[model samples]
Target chain A: MKARDLMRRDLTSVEPDTLVHEAVYIMEQSGLSTLPVVDEEGKLVGIITEHDLIQAALPEYFEMLHSVTFLPNLNQIQKRLKEMAFKPVSEYMKEVFSVHLDDEDLHIADLLIRKRLKQIPVVDGEGHLVGVIRRIDILSRLIR
Target chain B: MILTVTLNPTLDKFYWVEKLPLSLERVEEEILIRAYKSWGSAGGKGINVSVFLACMGVETVAMGFLAGHTGQIILRDLLEKGVTANFVWIEGENRTNVTIIEKGKEYHPVKIHEEGPRIPTHAQELFLKKYRRMLKRAEYVVLAGAIPPGIPETAYRELALEAKEAGVKAVVHAGRRALWEAVKTGPFFVKPDVREELVVGDMPVRTEEEIISAGKKAIEYGCSACLISHHVTGDILITPEGIWEYEIGVPPTAFKNLVGADDALVGGIIYKLLQGEEIPEAVRYGMAAGAASLEVEAKMCLSPAAIEQEMKSIKMEFKEPL
Candidate 1:
């Protein structure tokens, strides 16, 4: 099977200027962990995932705390989240990583496993977004 | 893509009522009235222009500050109408302009325009950043309409200058301070909004001579051309080379709604320009578009066919060389 056979065409995507809060709302409603970010021409540029959103709520230096027990106050996290809500998705979207439709299903599954990605965007030869294939899609094929 | 900016956008709500009470005599009573028909749409000079352009199958992106629930409605409307959205989200509710048209007074609709949200410093910064990025793909950037609260008076000046830097042609459709600021940047064209006050910048535009002088002043300020609305049925275009008058055969009484006529004119001109037409011919098409919108009740007459039909009656006459 090829990636095209497993990819879902109807997907929720966002523009770079979409507010973080609105992006999160779309993600929740669509039940998707990630959203592809496209430009006005509908060309894929980046992706925003749940991990990126949670990371936006944490401070830059939080990772360097060496797993200390004493955590940052809730107020501080709330304040950071408030600021992030108004910022555009461009600030939080991850670097683009996509697979072409002609790519083999095995190759996509291997990349997904190695990269530990929940979903991978499917693009055409010209880099325009065509669809997205999720890890669950590959796993469900065995049951079917 | 044509990028149109409406810094202060509105959701226009229009109602067709049988009659509107002239006097509310009792202060304690909550008077109730019913409307036979009602409609709402995304509004703002730039948005109106975008709607018109989209109807003509032109790719246009509308950018500005949008806020609250009303902003969502406006964005949805723009998307449904085929105009790409790139608005910066801000805090506060977008204003809604209400118009009540009585059965016999369709020509004299009572309009109440609200003041929209105040843009904070951060939102303004974000908008400029997005604007610069979008300018990369735009053929022309149209700066139209009123400047909202908390925005600098030099907003149009800065935007026009940025468009110039980006090598994109800029068309400024504004009035008063915004018009004055943009005129200094030598935009491709300048259309002064003289609806509220018959004035452009500090000059009075009430008389034909004053309008000509004001247009000349704008030309002196570095604008390539200045188009001023002379009356309901005509407009005057002044360039460094010569002046031309554009008039439609329709009378004022023939207009169903004059609200979005100016925006259609600007949008029509840009649409024609994108089709590789010259400035004179584009302005003629734009006049026809304005006349077409005047005959309809919708914010803009969205049919290119209608605009073409109206174009047949447009009279363009060259007055004299400047």
Candidate 2:
């Protein structure tokens, strides 16, 4: 199967000026975990995922402060979260991944495995958001 | 004059694209999207209230800590909306909020907030100093939104108290921690989300009865009135005299890409209250404004004439305070 045949035509996306906090709300409301970040011209600039947001919201030293001597500061983490509350998603979205409409499903799935991406956006030749294909969409290809 | 204190403000941008993919497995990673449309406007709780107030023909002033290029954009937009502003200059840039709406039948709406710049101690003082001067001439003062870092939770309380002492009614909408402090100052009114009871008040208010009981305690602390907004179930209004339940009768007309519905509610209430309308009438006006915002694609308020028509469908039931 090719990406065009397997990819779902519907896509979730946001603008560069969109806040990361509101992105979380959209994901939760829509029950989707990923969103493509587009610029004013509708060009796909980056992609944001649940992991990207959670990691960005956390304090920089969150994983490193497990020691009892200097425990993780709740106040610092709260401050980080509050700060993230007003930040735009353009700051942390991944710009490296995207797929062409005619790309083969095998290549797309291989890229998903290599990058550990949950969703890959399908775009037309003009870089317009057309659809999306997730990891499971092509799993049937391997099974059969 | 109505003074809106948005300690932190942002540029709100909206982008319309396609319907969201529900299942993760259904989509590919990279997609180019042709943005059908995009828009930007004023954001921040107090700023939104000011925008709505201006739409209702009220003279409103927006105040807050602003800095950098993003702040300038917000200031320019505020002026475009006919709201005068005097923001305290601070270091770093202001934040931007993005709202993404999918254009299909679902009308999926996703919002993202940027982590705003932190205000320095000196900048905080400058803002408060401005607050002191403006409170003296203000007829109504609105305190709203999340308290930015380095600013104490008591910030709203202090502002609200200043308004009260000046014989101006203060309306505050904030989270639990700030709400607790603000209620003690006894602004004319306090409106916290229904979930706030668990976060800031003495009880968890899921049902109507619980909301009234918890809201009463908040009112008795300092304010003359309180409102609890439950977006889906509707809202509850309480005062020392009695309590009332507001039924929008229908959901917000436009849910997608609709921001500031709550702020419009706050603005509508203040508009009617300043005109000497009763609490129930004011509450109705608030509901209509909120409903009007639901259908709009941008973060703009409905005109009073339009809201007046929507107000007819709102039903209010006065449940005597328990």
Candidate 3:
């Protein structure tokens, strides 16, 4: 079927500059690994997945604590946490792997199979964000 | 630890034909029939994602509502794929999705979705309780797909809040009220396609610059990053650091079935995260996985080898918007 038929009209999205913690919450609530990053105009721009957020949150340094016989280094762990806390998702987000609307549903399917993506954005002719087609959506269609 | 919840799951039925006539005519006994049939298990978004993750060798748990003969099928499929599943038993059929493929030189498949059985209030409550318990053990909780009819839109929101309180990351892959409500909980990731965004009156996001701006706005609404999965152009990712874009070009092979591509993407991202790959690397893997899924028929996700092969040839360009 065409993308318009298979795509999900309702969607959850986020804009850039969103706090890493807040994005984490949205992902938890929605059960989505990736979110469409858009502009004030709602145009499709980039995508941020759970991997990106996790990478952004990775600690930059490890702290070394007072030497205890076999205990792990508390100071190093603290240092790492501090560095990670300061890091932003922007430093880790992927800048690519997005799809557009106007492209055929067949093309989209091919992209998904070739790219192995779970979700593909449906943008309007102007490249504005429109709908989303998830592998689940396609699977739902297949089973029905 | 990514936890996916599948209240109901099922095996997908795929029927292939040379072409779908508006009306079917009976063929004579002498005439030969040309068609193909295939089956794969799928139900909620969570299960689909888990299947992909398992294929990619990512450790994951698939939980949710289950019952009836169809539920057995789902369990069998999960076991076959080596995915860990923990489902609460209930009454009713698990549900099914049908795919009709019109096979010419090119195959065109039409998907018909079946609404699952209504989830009783008590069962829903029990599932929620179980989910809350599971959330504590997970680093990431994925609440995927549409909640059965009779379920409240606020269900995802409540679950998300619970996860957050427990210091777990939440990922929501839902639509409409469910999606809007979940956003208030401040999830780590929100994946919305263009159509879903437009339905929410959050459209007009065109161009890379516009998408970046929108991603920033979503973060203001309590999202860590916004991943816009476009159909035609590519993808737009907005995070606290900055905005980035990836354009998915045409695939090398012809279209077979569009099913399971997104699940492949999810699987790819989760695999990378578990492996400690950075976001950019994860995106590449996700893109490759999605592309590979497109090449296969039915709802089956592509193999890792296929994904890796595609990853090597795929190229993505990054540019700073003016």
Candidate 4:
């Protein structure tokens, strides 16, 4: 199948300056882990994933824990959650490893499988937002 | 904190061949066999979940029966992976699950499962005793997979009861009698494939819509969550909160093998759950993990980096009730 056939036409995106909490909420509500980062012009600039948000939310002291521990440190957890609620997508969105709209669906699948990616943003020649290709969307084609 | 019991585990052997002809006298050689050495782990449903929980940095203990050379290998692998195991040594060899992949064809991997060790009555008693002792410390107990020939199907029900007595959350991942019996006790989770649901619940699960309905019904049967792993349609997760659907995308490269995809899915779900993700989020992680496992060489662990990357893009949606 072609990229246009597999990609979702309705785009859910976030501006580069959008708050991290808003991005997280969008992902949680839409059941999406990544969001395309767009500029004020609605042009694709980068992408953000749950992992980025997780790493951003990790406290400096988390790496020092050696034993199995529950999420007992509510103060630290809340502080990180608050930070994610305030920071902008521009601070954490990955600049590299994105796809364009003209790219073939197979090409997008290649990127997903090769890079082990979950979602790839599809943009126009001038970098305007167009669509999004997700792993499940591509996998659904296999059933057919 | 989590305990998984595996009775018959093995090192999966995967053979890849390109374009399998329906009936050929002597096909030319294009077959490639990749063997992955897995840790000494329990070979059933509970054990698989424990392996993943350990990988996700959870304090997990695995208990079950092991025997012969393959049994020893399972132990070695689990120890190396840092998973604590308390298995009863029995007589006989662990069985291997084989996958023959016909290249160029979609979903053409043929899986052949070997019968595992025969547990003597004495060993069975020992296992039950050990499990009872272990249940005291377990926060969650996952009873997974098929029972060996000599074992009664009611074994899972008894275990579930014991877990319930200890105030531990029990998750059952089996079919037929075991699944039906577990449901009476109200398990934390029940994951049945469509065929199993059809046989056990007498429900039609031909399409995605039917599967979702059946899954909801399973939840109504006292399970906290119902997960259906479809052969072609991916997976559907149904919880009291809502229903979520996850579909797999074709990998960039042609699929090499799908031998451990379901196990990988189980692993992914446990991994996410340990990370404190909700049921829906855990299912997405499981789907990505299952899909990623299809691209791996053999019985190896699904790449964590790959899963993390896939987690970023995998899409899931709540299914509106029809």
Candidate 5:
């Protein structure tokens, strides 16, 4: 089946001007860990994933830490989060890798496995967002 | 930011067909009716208002209940129009309201609307929580359209009251019980839906005198302003200061579609209000937006230039209430 056939078209997207807090609320409500950031022209500009938000909230020297428990207190992390909460998503949103509607399911599955992505945004010929294809969607469709 | 609530939203699908058969007599045989053109957009009274406001560069967030596959299409369209979505996902499917326009009969399109999904108790609670959070950032909140099943009719009242507590101006663009309920909370503005009924509760708005009386009654109920439709090309606005008549100089025959004209009017007014324009001037811009929408094939007048041009043909006259 084509990506269009198995894609979950019900995903909600965020705009670039959307605040980080608002984006988090939408993600929580929709049960989505990643949200495609779309611009006014309906083009997919970026994506806000759980990992991206975590990186923004974490200290700059987080990767250098021996362990997460090595942190003295969460005050540093809390302050970072509060400061980033009101900022626009565009500040922290990362570039998104996408697939077209006509892309073969096997190619999408391969990309998901190689890239370790949970979901890939689907765009039309003009790069307008169509929907998204999750790893589970392809697996379930293939199994069926 | 302007926040809009549409309890019952739909995916408005417009199809241009050569003809619409009165009946399908052959039940056993397969029949095919082809459409030459088709368009779909997010629709609901408040949703339409949000879309128009977004197009005008006003920050707007649309809050409502969305469900199933139909909800997906609605969300995509909303994002495309630049309106932020903060809807609660519920069980069942969102509605698909179809408008079939026959060739040369563009003025009179056949509309078929489905009653949308019922809002469960949990969904209602979740929506209120989200609404309160959104209210903190909203300068104005618009409660519009019909109240869907499983949701209380007093929902708008509760919301308007909360907005009042938050110091956010509330605009109620609904009719019947929903209008009456929200009016009691003393909204910033109330525009009664006169399409289904010519009354705000028991108040008759069929005649000019009666329309003024209805508007007065709502104002007496604590609303700042009350706007009622007078005719196809005219509407009457009543506020504490005085009454004003808005009329577009163009003939009614110039209208091609009247679907989202009222929404455009409300949105235009809010857009101007956000720009610090007074109520009268804002309403004038709104009337022009409605007139512009009337002349277009699309549901709304998307071009700011078109609305500006239509303003030249709109005339606003003040009057003493009878």
Candidate 6:
């Protein structure tokens, strides 16, 4: 089956300029890990993922210090969250990857396996999001 | 203290735009109107519940999983509100959720959500350890919202069972598979939104009767009580005594945003329950809190007077089967 066959059509998306918290709520409610960022015309311009958000939340030395101690400073965490919380999603969103509708399922599966991605958004030739294919979709339906 | 569990907590952002230029225009020529107001707060079902509870003068503790930078935002937000934060620190970053509201779009706001960090097994174990410690003081525990990745769907069930083992009453406000699993653990109460479905329940609940029937079945399945919301149809509260029906007529809508309404409803119920009110009065208070939620933009707390006034309009009926 093509990627479109197994893709989810009903989508939840946001404009890039949308503030950070609004975008976060949309993703949380939709239960999507990644959101395809679109312009007003619904054409994909960029994409945001949980990784991008987590990166935004973390300080520069987060990875270096995460293993150092389980009890990180509470004051520092709160201060950073307050500072980054109001920023626009455009500031934190990544120009990440997307798949085309006509791409072969095997090709898409290769991308997923190579990248270890959970889901990839699908777009038409016009760059309009048609659907999304998740790794779970592929595993549940195609991976004999 | 009332403890709330948000397995997938998030950083919530709200943007209010006067007019969004939907059409493609020359960037040099078009004067685009961007957002005039934006609000930032911690976001999660459990966090929102704690926010509401704290606003209503209830002592609430916001707990669950947090990772990376966004988790800090959640902690700060909760601490700022004076809600206790007892979260299990994780290795991944918490997600950021955004909502974009245009002037004309009252009900349909643009929402973008990021899936939260996957819970490593070690982190999950740490959370259980924390939960055990917190349960010693927690009289009421609310296990709300989604179960993050890398965690089994039975996560809520196990948490509810743990709360029960600690002699704490568990309240669930969730949807679909998570709600199904939570109900099986025999929570004190379960509230399911009709717009969402309990897929594990295997019932396509639509009308009032369907909603009631579903609640009845949920009680039979295991939970002590169930509240099924038929969105526009009606809301049914099923318990061992009988079914308490509440029809929330057209909300007293001064302004409408559905974002925190469920949290408000659940918070209201918990608020009255903490005050030692009977089930009917507490549900009535909950109905008013929910209706009052529509009157304002998402506020940290609903006004007590507004809830009292809105309670005047809501008609709650108790139907005890003979």
Better of 5 and 6 by TM-score: 5
Backbone clashes (count) for model 5: 0
Question: In candidate 3, residue A31 scores what lDDT?
Answer: 54
Candidate 1, residues B1-322: lDDT per residue as tens digits?
Answer: 8999999999999888888987988878987779998899999999999899888888778888788889878876876687766666676789999988887676688999998999988778767876887787789999999899999888999999999999999999988888888888888899999988888888888777888898898788777789998987889998898788999988877877778899999999998889899777899999999999989988888888999999999999989999
Which residues of candidate 5, in runs, are more than 4 Å off? A1-144, B21-33
Listed in order, the DockQ scores are 0.11, 0.01, 0.01, 0.01, 0.07, 0.01
Where model 1 places Cα greater than 4 Å from the true spot, the runs are A1-45, A55-144, B25-29
lDDT of 2 by residue, B248-269 (tens): 7554334544578788889998
* Candidate with maximal lDDT: 5
Q: List the residue pairs that clash in candidate 1.
A: none
Quick one: best DockQ, which candidate?
A: 1
Winner on DockQ (1 vs 6): 1
Instruction: List model 5 lDDT by residue over B109-191, tens digit each.
Output: 78898988999886787678667867877899999998898988899999999999999999999988988988988899999
TM-score of chain A of each: 0.91, 0.86, 0.72, 0.83, 0.94, 0.88
**In terms of TM-score, which candidate is stronger, 1 or 6?**
1
Q: What does the lDDT read for residue B117 in candidate 6? A: 91
Interface RMSD (Å), every candidate: 7.6, 18.6, 15.7, 24.2, 8.7, 17.5
Q: Residue B293 in model 4: shift from native, Å?
A: 1.6
Clashes of each: 0, 40, 133, 17, 0, 22
Q: lDDT: which is higher, 3 or 4?
A: 4
Q: What tens digits encode model 1's per-residue C-alpha lDDT throughout A1-144?
A: 987677765334777998998787666544567989987656799999988887778776777874425565667667888899989999989897789989999899998999989999988786766678889889998578
- Stretches of model 6 off by over 4 angstroms after superposition: A1-144, B20-33, B198-200, B232-234, B249-253, B320-322
DockQ of 3: 0.01
Native contact recovery (fnat) for each candidate is 0.00, 0.00, 0.00, 0.00, 0.06, 0.00
- The runs of at least 3 residues in candidate 4 whose Cα sits more than 4 Å from the true structure, single-residue gaps closed, are A1-144, B17-44, B194-200, B231-233, B251-253
**Rank by TM-score (best first):** 1, 5, 2, 6, 3, 4
Tens digit per residue, CA lDDT, model 5, A20-121: 987887676566899998776557899999889888898878878836687889898889989999999999999888999899988999999998999999
